[model samples]
Target: MQDWAGVFIPLVLFILLSPGLLFQIPGKCRIIEFGNFHTSAISIIVHAILFFSLAAIFLVAIGVQMNLGP
Candidate 1:
């Protein structure tokens, strides 16, 4: 774990999780047309995308491989 030396993994996890906790999934999405994206599914999709993006960026910056192979 050379790349993870002296690292604080919990901080990265917190950053990745904060968006989901803080985002207000609108009851009715108004930014688009011909679509019903106000559902919980859509909100969850957006949250997942955001979380992954944050994780990707943070992990890359810290020089870690984005993998969870058992």
Candidate 2:
């Protein structure tokens, strides 16, 4: 019974927050290298915090409630 916001919002957020997926912004932290790919630990943590905050805000704004139990 959920609308588009239920699915679409999280999907977009996931893509945007996933490290080395869409964009790579290596801030002051050292970049970890494996072969040709590189990513920063600080950047990943920042993205995770940002994602959680945004997701919470969006959920509240969209009036989506969660049921924890059956």
lDDT of 1 by residue, 1-70 (tens): 2444225554556554443344424334443223342346665666567666766666667555434344
lDDT of 2 by residue, 22-42 (tens): 555554344432232445787
Per-residue lDDT value at 25 in model 1: 44
For model 2, name the residue pairs that clash: none
Candidate 1, which ten residues in sequence have the lowest lDDT sum? 30-39
Off by over 4 Å in 1: 1-20, 25-39, 62-70
Model 2 Cα displacement at 19 (Å)? Answer: 2.8
RMSD of each: 8.9, 6.9
Per-prediction TM-score, please? 0.42, 0.56
Local distance difference test, per candidate? 0.49, 0.65
| Residue 27 lDDT in candidate 2 | 41
Q: After superposition, how far is residue 28 of candidate 1 from its true place, in Å?
A: 3.3
